[model samples]
Target chain A: MELVRIQKQDFSVTEEIELVKAVSKSIGGVVVFLGTGRDISKSEEIVRLDFEHYPGMAEKKLQEIRVRALDNFNIIEMGIVHRIGKIEIGENIVLIVAAAQHRNDAFMACEWAIAELKRITPIWKKEITKKGEVWVEEHP
Target chain B: MVKIRFFAMLKNKVGQEEVKLDVPENISLEKFKQILKKEFPAITEFLDKKSIMISVNQEFATKNTMIKDGDEVALLPPFSGG
Candidate 1:
């Protein structure tokens, strides 16, 4: 199954993988990348994170990344999901699953997908600290 | 008229998500930006930053890109997504 979505609800990795496996039985390896919110940054304690995205363009860019990954890598199929709105610390932020005939392709595609998402996706995060709210401008 | 959308810190600083300006037809993105700065005085500094980017019709655009009626333009700050 091919999935490219932006949502506010939490997702189940097992369910997503099951859907990916349904696409082809020849898939021998699957690599899943899950990015979660951490509580600490630059010695400050983060209470929560508010994620904002450009409504129509964010999804369009995600789909573009998915297409590029499929064409550039040897992966058979892939799925991507990003959570938006208010998220508590330790919550999931994004998920990427790359399915391929071998472990190398899955691993490579999964890494490349996450990097592209960070580089081009029109999503931003505001860190709510005990001191105050700060917009995270740097991509690290 | 062209619609300009703001997001993240730019939205907070500008105090609105979007605005429609009655700009002249076939104006360059740079010229439209000058008009936007005059209209929204608070975003002048942010607009000058090299990190800030512009998108026309949902794709990344350069200053030389031309703008016309009904085009959707977005002023994007640095992307900090995963």
Candidate 2:
């Protein structure tokens, strides 16, 4: 089973990992990566972050990453979720769960999925600092 | 008419989420973008800097990609998601 979602509501990482783990009995290991809203960015105090996405295309790109990871890695299933709208500091921003028959496969796939998501997903974040708000456009 | 969508900083620059344009059928994506740049000068910097990307029907599109009436076209800036 594979799950890909873009939502404004926060999600439970444990629950998401459990759902992926339940997909196969032979799955021996699971790796999860959680991204939370940070209070500081580039030495500036960020009060909050506002995330925006390109609607249909954002979800489509995420699903594409999941399918590609499953095909390229030994993972049995992958779950990905990204939160949108206004997010306060320390709030959950994204989650990725990778389940595989071995720990190395899960670890590698989980890392690759997050990197790919950052690279291709049509999502953006604006840093609401004490001074002002600025949309983050630099990928490097 | 084809629908042109904008997201992230590009949306803010364009001052709208989406707009309808009476574009010629089978217009190359490059030409369509040229028209857009002429129409919305605010986004010209992004287009020139190559910071913007075009997607047709929710997929990445190239300059040679052909766009037709009723197709969904989007201008996407760099992705920052984790």
Candidate 3:
């Protein structure tokens, strides 16, 4: 299956893992990382977060990350899914899953992929707080 | 012509998603910013704050990079997505 996905729909960890494992019965380890919106931002209460992405470019960057992760790690397969548009507090925001023959490879690739995705992907979020709106800053 | 795209707060601030311009060949990225500042005055303040990043043809670009016609240049605010 194609690994990179950018959609507004929420994702499921179990379903994602099933998709990967179904590809190969030899897969023994699967690591999944799920990110969700929180209610607080810098001590302020947030009602929701509005996620914006450059549709064509963001997907391209994600595909690059997926390719790099596969090349660097021993993982057999990987998946990346991110949610876009306005999301309420506690809603699912992103999902990543890695499958490998062993636990170490699955864990390492999943961690590295998520970190790289956060660093380079052209995705941004706007916080809708009680005090009004604030665009979140990239840490890197 | 080259297309310049804006996203996130930059899009809201600029009041539009994209603009296409008939840019001269071999214009440095820094000089391109000057043109944008003059044309879209709303982006001027954001540039002063260093709150935006530019990408040339979907890749992060340096000010020294040369830009030409048919390239897609995007102006982005700091990304906050996870």
Candidate 4:
């Protein structure tokens, strides 16, 4: 069983790696994805980004995603962390880690988890650009 | 009784984050929206014309769907998260 978290604090890669190692003793592979704030959106320069979420609901949704991944994939461990509040350019936004007995499952599950998170999660990000602040509506 | 929640832009338009409605048993989401509009006229502008998604008990739902007491309903705006 893996833990899922949605918070406003920064995460350390070392801590995440250690968590992955501790959960899956039989793991043969680990896959991780880090989503970061980018400097540009649709050819405009971004200054800062603000993320807002429906607090309790957002956590519940992330837990549901974690459960769905476990039910759909043959993975030993999985964990996801999403950052909230204001963030600067190049800061970490989200992180996912999947560990499985095979390399293929680990990679595939990680991708699926992130894709589903983007599609279904209620958290929204607003980008403050040099031109103006715009609320992003879709991941496209 | 059912509790409905609104988030993001929808929340801003409705000027409320959540509301409790004493709906008749087995009321459809469409009728619920009507009641909401009547109760909160400010929401009419957002509900009548804007694109909003519904979730029943945290899962996606359509307007024709029926809801029960104690059910949790949510009106979501266009998702903009990574």
Candidate 5:
């Protein structure tokens, strides 16, 4: 939960922030990006979503992104956790938390990490709907 | 025997998560893709170079990338997860 975690269980935002704060020293700002599943996509009512990731590769890519952020920014604590399996509408699916001595580093590193994670990480999702299903092929 | 892994809709179309591809040694990723094209011709649109991405040994690969013995290759569709 400190660096990188990919799990099926839901995560506690409070616990995550506390851990980051507990571990880091003299951090001025903290930025966290919490991603949630939506009730609708493309105007279709999505009941829930089934998330699948390429086991080993997904973690590797996530760690790679994390490392790149560490190298580029002056961040102190960084944690990226993504949840798999079935996730309901409005449920949290992923969390990105970055702590830094400066507010800019915290915000920029947080944004950059998620952008890279969404771009390359091999985690996938299938939106299950009453009309059947849809494979979500793109992300924001 | 090289292992070809699939994910998401690609896995569903192939009816499984992975398949063993039998091929000569040192084939380019492009050629192996052609082999896959012949094997699962039903979903050729997913095979388009623009739509699909290849990872060799867990690193994103290009068409000229070579496949070696016992390499792990994955054909992925456009990723859609946060």
Candidate 6:
């Protein structure tokens, strides 16, 4: 099974690669996406961002997403890490890594994983702008 | 008894995260919602027009579904996360 974690800790690129390598023996390709806090929202300068989650429910939902990805894809290994609490502009927000015996599976699974996470996860973010902070709403 | 949970904006609006109520036996979700509104008058405005998502036993559910005793129901607004 894949290892999934939703935490409020800082993650390093080197650490993420190591985690992926630990699960796959003959991995031909690995794809990773790191989402960062942006500086602008609705044409306004964002100073910082705040994230909140329903502790237990958030972790449970992430685990369900991880299981669904494993069942649908032929990837050998996957790791997802999402940060919580206050984050500054340009700081890392989420990380996803998918490893597979072939490049296509790695790339596609990674893309699908993050998209589903954004769509289904219960974590909420508020953008701190120059004027005031506003909680973001779902897009479509 | 069923435990009803709320999150995010709904929690802030309701001013409470969870509540336990003894709903009528074999009650539909729609009726349960009505009962909730009667019990918590403050939530009526939010329940009127907001597209609140329901979760029965941690899975997404619809309004017509039947809820049983001891079921854990959650009211979630549209997810706003990345």
| Top candidate by DockQ | 1
TM-score: the better of candidates 1 and 4? 1
What DockQ class does candidate 2 belong to? Answer: high
Clashing residue pairs in candidate 1 are: none
lDDT of 3 by residue, A1-140 (tens): 45579998877778877888887888999999999889986789999998889888899988998899889999898889999998999999988899999999999999998898888888998889988998888643
Whole-model lDDT per candidate: 0.93, 0.90, 0.87, 0.83, 0.89, 0.81
lDDT of 6 by residue, A1-140 (tens): 23677777778867887888787688888999898999987789999988887667777888877778778998888888888889999889888888889989989999998888877777788888889877777643
DockQ of each two-chain model? 0.90, 0.84, 0.76, 0.63, 0.88, 0.61
* Between candidates 3 and 6, the TM-score winner: 3
What iRMS does model 2 reach? Answer: 1.0
Candidate 2 matches the true fold with a TM-score of 0.97
Provide the TM-score for each candidate, comma-separated: 0.97, 0.97, 0.92, 0.85, 0.96, 0.87
What is the full ranking by TM-score, best candidate first? 1, 2, 5, 3, 6, 4
User: Candidate 1 overall Cα lDDT vs. reference?
Assistant: 0.93
Ranking by lDDT: 1, 2, 5, 3, 4, 6
Local lDDT at A77 for model 3: 87
Error of 3 at B48 (Å): 4.9
Candidate 3 chain A: minimum summed lDDT over ten consecutive residues — where? A1-10
Q: Which residue pairs does candidate 5 place in steric collision? A: none
CAPRI verdict (incorrect, acceptable, medium, high) for model 5: high
Tell me the tens digit of each residue's lDDT in model 1 across A12-98.
889988888788999999999999999999999999999999988999999999999999999999999999999999899999999
Candidate 6 whole-model C-alpha lDDT, 0 to 1: 0.81
Candidate 4, residues B1-82: lDDT per residue as tens digits?
9998887666766788899988889988888889878987876776776566778887778767899999998877777776
* Residue pairs with backbone overlap in model 6: none
lDDT of 1 by residue, B6-72 (tens): 9999998899999888899999988888998999989999988889989999999986799999999
